[model samples]
Target: MATTNKTGAIGPVPFMNDGSAALGVPLAGLTGDDPKLWVRFYQGTWVLATFVPAIASIQQSFRPRGGDVVIASIPKSGTTWLKALAFATMARGVYPPDTAAEHPLLRLNPHQCVTNLERLYSAGQESMIEALPSPRLLSTHMHHSILPSSISKNPDCKIVYICREPKDMVVSLWHFCRRGKPDVSFSDLFEAVCQGTSVSGPFWDHVHGYWNASKANPEAVLFLRYEDMLRDPAGNVRKLARFVGQPFSPAEEEAGVVAQIVRLCSLDNLKNLEVNKPSSASQPFANDWFFRKGEAGDWVNHMTPDMARRLDAIVEEKLSGSGLSFA
Candidate 1:
């Protein structure tokens, strides 16, 4: 028998050892603390592990509607922040001082506020999706290729995609992966990221896929950059509001609704909130630090020059004809 680690439940089922060759795929590579062995899905080019086969297969059947609003991004690419922004925008009518303590926004993480395609396709999710009211708000990390076929074909559905600087994305992903699997070293993480070996990676492809979609179907897809949001949140919020057909009113604008939304979802504000910091309502990894350091250029502090150059080369090569450049 193969010696398994303490977190063996989370480890990959080695393809070599298994007799069911028909069921097993070749190992892509080892990554993260558990040295998670990865395998490519036959249906999608994206790689996941044997442990989460359900999550992979279940995600395929998820389809969003014309009324649905989805905040999409690769992992660690400002997903949390964008989720908060989208939730706040959608739920603007029932915000602070007006909504009670038991308000959905107060009680839930942005993830809870927005449905995930993967969650929707899981065994228990059919009822959940059916129960959700129409004009639903959702979020996803699925690549363009794997996104629900219905959503891509739907001309009326509005999809919002947020992109971030690849270097900063690497740093953020490193921290996020480290929290759950503390044994993963930064050096190893960086190499995996550079090699496009992380979950939902091949980073540039993820961004380019959405970017092209946004361009090809501007009416259906909206693309926003993290740096742009940081620089001019109000401007972007206004733009988003318009895109989603919820433009702020003169009274609301004068009352500083945009600023209020920004303050409510700020990293400092959300981090300090009781709901975000070790609360009963929070998810397994949910905590103050989950939204830690929502800045663009922090990668400069942690990434060495050689690593940065390598990442730049990767980005340059992948994004050569895309016309999109990281700031």
Candidate 2:
């Protein structure tokens, strides 16, 4: 069973003597962030964390609407793709497939199109998020258990979470961390990742949070796998549409609406866009950071046989008997 912190927040609190300390408290002798973060374990998951004003503000306030839709994921687990698909899925008639010229996906990075809950608090935009209209579109890396009570209890809210194969996810996250400059060595990072020492990880638990939620409340939370989505995106897109309560009409399907969304959100097209090309003001990371190889087995080039085996074992063990398998 998991425990609560001093703040009465439920989660995996690391090294808590009696589980009474507040979450996100900075500590010594840790090279936590990628040179800038003060990492913390809040209720058991990692956060690109800050304790003072940011956490204080979010913890005390920040309401979520019941009609909201959340694109939830562990970082680098196809967050951008999911956001684009969700926005495009909802904006179908508004932006229309052929009128991609005026589409927001054409103008803004996925991060911008869908506000990130954590980043909103970090950047002091909690009020803005709260003010978003009904049926808000947002994203979060928070585990399902730790999400605000307003969101978690809102029977009307919907969460769409996507997870990737363990090996591919780790590989992508490593490359993502090292993208802008030298941060952590891949070898060092690999061990830390396998040990579940990254933000919002023990990735398997993160996967299971929404996976179990989806099983328990299929209408409220939808769990999707990156591999499955990649293998059959149209079917997945259809699933997304239905989950979001915006299924395509027969007329829309006849107009190749499904095909357009898949093509429009394709990595190849997204990467080639000027907005996602190496530099852009709208992007927090390099536009290029989000566009690594989207293939599932890219880990082969990076992981040694032993390392690969280690991750495979962990994935198997963590997901064992849980009705979840990434491969």
Top lDDT model = 2
Candidate 2 local lDDT, 266-285, one digit each (tens): 88888888878875444346
Worst lDDT run of 10 residues, candidate 1, spans 12-21
TM-score (all chains, Cα) for each model: 0.83, 0.86
Q: Evaluate model 1: give its TM-score.
A: 0.83
For every candidate, C-alpha RMSD to the true structure in Å: 10.6, 9.6
